[model samples]
Target: MANGGILFLWCSSRLVRTPSFLLIMSLALADLLMMLKLPIFLIGIWCQGPCLGLFGCEMYGVVSVISGMAAIWSLTAIVVERAWVISFSKLGVISKLKWYTAIEVVLLIWISAIVVSVLPLAGWNRYVYEGYLVSCSIDMYSNNFIDKSYVWLLVFVGWVGPNILIFYCSYAIVRANRRNNTLMMELMAVGGDTAQNFQKQRILEERRLWRVSSMMLTVWMGSWTPYTVVVLFNATGYIHLINPHIGMLPAVFCKTSAAVNPFIYGFCLPKIKGEALKLLKRYRSTRPSPENSSRFPNSSPARTPRPSIIHMISINNRHASTSC
Candidate 1:
């Protein structure tokens, strides 16, 4: 949880200038909350044996449901954002909005998710401790069809929904890139001009966007597909073949998506990577070196000046002159 939170903080700092950053940050926040909630749920299961008392269980249920739903909705928002970016490149329909609009959408997602989850507590659906293993989930095999309905609803909204949206975004981005490349070639064949150069640059930017979008879509699908498939099987009453421990693996895999976001953004985007390197250098400069300790007081080493790239270039020029 702490690591996920730190990554979220980094992503938030790096992406503060972009509107799409809100969606990414929201997903990170949701993952962080889920990570936090997991420990508490585990503790409850350990101490109280799956049947949590009124107070603790209620809080756990709320946190679990909220975080889970927030994660789904955040992914949905990302899919929508990517879709907009790819489908309508120059229009700026979705990207022009203020960050608060994204926040509002995220808030609504959580609110709706919590409302749906709380329905079971109110007798519309049912939640119970099936065994020492299962804590708080809709009882899949319950007599209430509401429980079954809720499972399918989550499967559709959380799993299939985002997958379809992301696939569409990926397809659109690829098609756009192909079209842009063809246009650029045609323009180049007509001879270079200021407008042609500008168009070429725009096409390059679109290609870059497509690459990043594809990477993110690949990660999301690879990480969450297993978990969703497992859930689908469980919901349909094929528990005999599925191990409970196997379900946890998918959750862990899905959590990795949050952790990987900062690294993905940093490595794939040169601007972000440069900023991260600068921050790292600044942090190292401020931190004290081990050689500066009192134990080495008698032996103060002389500080060597670090050579700049300009100095290296000058030295290379002098060496070439001497050789000549």
Candidate 2:
């Protein structure tokens, strides 16, 4: 929770204007919400025992699905934007992604999450307490056709579709990086000035992008795959794994993604690191050091200053006298 909170502050403070940064901020915000909600379930279990009442269980399910879906969609948007930037040289850079496009993506993510989340409330599927009766989900244990179809739809739209896009973007990025490296090498062979430096810089950026993308995809897969498998089995009536203890494991694993996303997405970026250092320096400068206090006892380090009313009145009197 602390890590995610700090990262959210850093991203919002430093990178608010950039397009890619906005998407990252969106992801961070979703993760922050997840961090907030999961503890309630834990505390409830510890205090009141595993099985929360119907209201609490339903609330947990709503929050989990919304935040989880938003995180996944935000990641999908990030990978797609990065891939577009790499493959299309004319876009200039990923950071400058148009405001309209960024807003559209964010809107789509939240709206889709809300619409899907409300479907159960609207009578399509149902949210019920599951997994030891402490955790809540989309009632995957039901074998009816409506429930099964809704589960399939949710899995495909919420998880499978995004994963496919992420994978495709990853592949395209690799191909684009290879092609760029080849061109850079050929230029170097022809004695192009600064070709080697350019090659090295591009290599570093490609490596960073690859690392970030792979880590995100890997975490997403690891966190959700078990739960997905369990849900599918339940939907198809192929498995009768009815033990609450066994059923809860996948849900617990999936919650780890909420904690893991901040580290992977925020701190991994060089830009974010630079911004963090700058902010730290600014914060330190604004504090009253011993040396500064000794040099000027009455002066305090402040970014902005406001004059007292008395001072303003004195200034106004002096202006009147000069005018007279």
Candidate 3:
């Protein structure tokens, strides 16, 4: 929850307005909601059983499935958007990526997550207590065919497929935004403009959103990969190799991603960093310092001596490789 709150503070106004940033913000929101589940979980633990008994277990299971799916799929959306924008940035499609499109994308991801999570309640499979009966999830350990099939289907939909797309998109972004290719695209976009224009264009692409996005995805996958392995072991009839205690570790590991996501996002985006810097300067100037603060109590930052024709264009273009 703090992760999402801190990100909200850093990503103010225009920073979170873009399509890609909206997806990223959606991921943070999912994590925040997931963290809110922690209190119920702790209460259950304190009771030495499921809180509210079976009903509590059911609710927890449903919420877990929903938030987990939402977070992972939101990562997919962010990376996919980054790849699309950066790969085709020279085509001037950045202007075409609008707020409504982003809102629709986020809504679709949420709807899909809800659908996948509630399937267990609809008799496709069913949730059951797991890990000493304090928590619940889809019954991956069951012998029933539908129960077994649901786990496999989920792995395919949530992990295998999205990861393939993530990797391919990451590769595409790298290929399309390589130094030479970046120059070529900028040259074409500028239509034989001066070197000064070339330099201005370069500034807009300096902070690639895909770079931080890849880091977030990698960390998220690393945290969940162990739980995935456990699920696979159970589904493949290798359950003897796993135990309840071992199973608990991976589930705990998965929560670490929620805690770490804010740091990655807060420090990584250029616009956030710029805004943070401005805020920091303002803060320091307001403090009772001896030299700088006293000498210029109300001094505003001096504007750059040269005015930029490309300033707005650069900021608008910030939505592309930089991802708002």
Candidate 4:
């Protein structure tokens, strides 16, 4: 959580001005909230039971679901934004999108997440303590038709849908890259011009976006798919396929996504990285260094040195002589 917070703060600083920074911040906030669930589950264990009781367990389940949904949706939104921006950069109007537009898109993602999360509370599904007893979640073992239907619904809408969108956007980006490369080669053969050079720059940005988006999708699926598969097996009354203790593995894996986001988003992009370095230098320069403070306890800074008594007297004498 702290890592995500620091990353978000660094991105929000004026040093990084890209509109996509908002998407990164949204993802960080989701992961941070998800990480908080660790303590909530621990509290349940320390008490030898569901520490927050039934109501607390229900809220915990809702929060976990909401955070997961928000994070995935934010990721998908980021991919879409990057793909759209690059694919249509030739259009003057499309290139004019502002940072606030990204904020609105993030808001929409959270709204969709909230809607899906609250469906259980509206009686479409339910939450309960799992086999571990340390955490609460959607009761995957329930044999009730409503529970089964809800699980499938969540699998499709929450997981499958965003993944499909991600894959599709990635495909679009790849195709765009291929076409841009062909065009660049043809233009170079004929002698490259300013427009071709500009296109080449945009192509580079698109390639970076494709690489990052692909990695984000891979990491997300790698982390959460195990949990989803385990839940599906449990829902189908095949719990024996997975070890009882191993059921919690997916939750642990999912939380690790929070740890990975700071590294991927902050350290990957060159523009953001250059700005981050500048920010780090500014931070070091502004902070009070203990070594410097102890060495100069009473003196004015060297930048504007104070005049000594002898210098003051010499100046006074000089002034008197001039007056005389």
Candidate with best TM-score: 2
Q: Give, for candidate 4, the lowest lDDT window spanning 10 residues.
A: 90-99
lDDT of each: 0.65, 0.78, 0.73, 0.77
Q: Candidate 3: misplaced stretches above 4 Å?
A: 10-15, 91-96, 179-214, 276-324
Each model's Cα RMSD: 14.0, 9.5, 19.1, 7.4
Q: Score candidate 1 by lDDT.
A: 0.65
Using all chains and alpha carbons, the TM-scores for the candidates as numbered come to: 0.69, 0.78, 0.73, 0.76
Q: State the lDDT at 14 in candidate 1.
A: 55
lDDT of model 3, residue 318: 78
lDDT of 4: 0.77
Which ranking of candidates, highest TM-score first?
2, 4, 3, 1
Query: For residues 1-324, could you state the per-residue lDDT of candidate 2 as single tens digits?
Result: 635654556445745457777788788877777777676777767775655677777777788888888988997898898888878863354344898899889989998888888888888878887766667888787778898788888789877998899899889888888787777677677555587677778789778767866777789898777768887777667668657777777777767887787667766667777777777789899887999779988784667778999999999999999999
How good is model 3 by TM-score? 0.73
Q: Comparing 1 and 3 by TM-score, which wins?
A: 3
- Candidate 2 versus truth, CA RMSD in Å, comes to 9.5
**Per-residue lDDT tens digits of candidate 4, residues 204-298?**
87778677767877887887787679767876678787764777777777788877876676556677667667777898999999997899887
Kindly list the per-residue Cα lDDT of model 1 for residues 1-324, writing each as its tens digit: 433533544655654446566666666677777677556556755785654565555566566567667776777777677657655764444446467877788778878887977876786655544334434555544445666677677678877887787677677767766776676676667565876787667778777877777788788777767756765676667766566566456555655675675456333456555655676688799987777766677676789999999999999999999999
Q: What lDDT score is found at residue 3 in candidate 4?
A: 55
